[model samples]
Target: MAQDDKAARGPSVAEGAALVDLLLQMADDDLVLGHRHSEWLGVAPDIEEDVAFSSIAQDEVGHAALYYELASQLGAGDADRLAFDRPVGERRSAAFVELENGDWARTAMRHFLYDAFEEVRLDACTRSGWQPLQRAATKVRREEFYHRLHSRTQLHHLAKAGGEAFARLEHALADLWPYVASLFDLGPHAAELRATGVLPADAAALRSAWEAVVVPELSELGFGVPACGGTDATSAAHRGAHHPALAELLTTMRAVLDVDAAAASW
Candidate 1:
């Protein structure tokens, strides 16, 4: 039987909690990044692309909501509070999401890198030794597949279109690649998750898998994969110290949410 199959039939309370933590990390990353992405809802360079981008943004937030619901079931509190109420420092998202959306190239670059990593990570979760996580991953993977495809489409177009778009995409990739790998950091829950057999793979292992999945695609797109030289604590960036662009993005995203603290519905 698969590890998840065995986990499904047993009393694995510890593994369940570890899974909850993992879920929170996954949900939080998507929520914050989606919020940043949605800031471009109507301002995309072209209307058709805007609409398509909006749907991807919506899918990410929707994915976050689903993961939050699962986390709440395991006692993580309501999704909104978990999302909006937390200060920036408490957020577990990597620095990539916290950076400003520069141009379409930068936005697309970030999306392509993130979506590629998310796919590999979510695939691991789907086959997780923790049963609830396996089920959650299965549902999330369905939506994420489209996210990856959308990003890949944008990547192809940007690479094929020369001049400004190509330059922007290349610049964005070089700037963001280091932080992209940091997405799998998993923070303090690393050892506990592995001990419980919930995560099964460590950050290093997952990073290797993510690189294998993304590098070839990027190379084909004429973008170079980030090298191993920049791997150090100097590369350890976090969302706590956000770019000035992040503030602007946050203001736009929370415009409605900031209206009334007690607003009951979104």
Candidate 2:
């Protein structure tokens, strides 16, 4: 088939599955991390942050909905079901998002790192040959711009606070760095996704893009940046085998539906 014709008809069955995998990876990460962010709604250190985190949580979940809708249109199933009803083993979320939100410093660090990762991922998606994904990514990237700004500003402030605040953030970065690789793991369909132009870049390219942004900023802030060896066992676990926290999180996320499984919609 000619290139334009192939693009017009969209991906083949195998490529569609790869696209679904990519979409789920994007959706699951946002949904899980958004839930984690929402946990701070009532208990954030201050009123301003309570509002900020709450808003960010909403944005993340909204982005997830966008991706899930796209995936559903491609025959993945109902968007709501895909978000809330999947078994833990079937989820494609990276471990970085599944970890509990630690202290304020840790949360801030994770927020900064994840936003950096998302920025790169969305940038790549904007160039995808799949028009739906390209448009969806462009839309999501607009909101994410502010998210990255907020997280970056918050990190700078925390880093400048010195003493205990500095120490806590440093420790958080060290602990979180290893899991950063998981965020870039594109799962089993990575090659197909890239070959078909569903994603313009592979996992390594995405990770490199993330590192280019994150490393320099952290170093400038005088924080010790940890080395990331990509695709380690820990990163591999995030591809299919998730941490126990994901199951607990899914339970909470599906609480309403769980009570009435026969309900038509959420």
Candidate 3:
């Protein structure tokens, strides 16, 4: 049987910290990117898209909250503290989530790319040896299908437009490949995570799989993706390293939570 086959089965002491780290990797990305997507709430180009992005934002934030709660159960910290109090350098989210969603092109393509990577990560998490994390990931995976469909549909529309829309999407897609490269990194606890069955794929394997899905799709849309290479391609950024934008983003996300001074409710 799997180590975490039973609902009450727990990670051993040797693997507990690794499990929490993995949870943070997943949770931090969701929380930060959720906030990023929320920035488009009232400002999206079209009203219909605005509502769709809003719903996605809510799902991502809710997923983050569940992971944080799971981490709390593991003695990491309370959900709010874990979300609001961590320094940018301490966060495990990728540079992709932290980058500015500058325009409709940037925003739409970024959303598509992120949704693609997230689909892979969440699928892996659903198979985790840790039951609670598995359950949380499995539950969240249902909501992600809609997000993927929405992003994929938008990309198809923009790419087929064959004029300014195609040009813009091509540019945005190229810009995103570097950041997405880091999405699957296993970080310091990589060995422990795989050894314990907490996660299944490594950074390289996951990136390759993501590319196999995305590159062809973008090419089919007439976007020419350059062969990915260098540090950006390899994704040296993970936990403990961060883009400056992350600090700015965290400041905005923490604004309200910092003011309340430990209140029980918002």
Which candidate ranks first by lDDT, i.e. highest? 2
lDDT of 1 by residue, 124-224 (tens): 78767767777888888998888988888878987999788888888888878766645767767678887666777778778778778778888887876
Question: Candidate order by lDDT, highest to lowest?
Answer: 2, 3, 1
Off by over 4 Å in 2: 1-4, 233-237
Clashes of each: 0, 0, 0
How well is each residue in 34-91 modelled by candidate 2, as lDDT tens digits? Answer: 9999999899999988998899999999999999998999899999889977899899
Give the CA lDDT, 0 to 100, for residue 31 in model 3: 91
Better of 1 and 2 by lDDT: 2
Angstrom error of the Cα, residue 224, model 2: value is: 1.3
Q: lDDT per model, in order?
A: 0.76, 0.88, 0.81
**Model 3 residue-pair collision total:** 0
lDDT of 3 by residue, 1-266 (tens): 75636345676676778888888888898998899889998999989988978999999999999998998998898988899889876898878787888789998898898888888888788878778878888889989999999999988987888999888877887777666656756788987787777886667767777788888998888888877542353443455556678899888877887788777778
Which stretches of model 3 miss by more than 4 angstroms? 2-9, 229-236, 260-265
**Number of the top candidate by TM-score?**
2
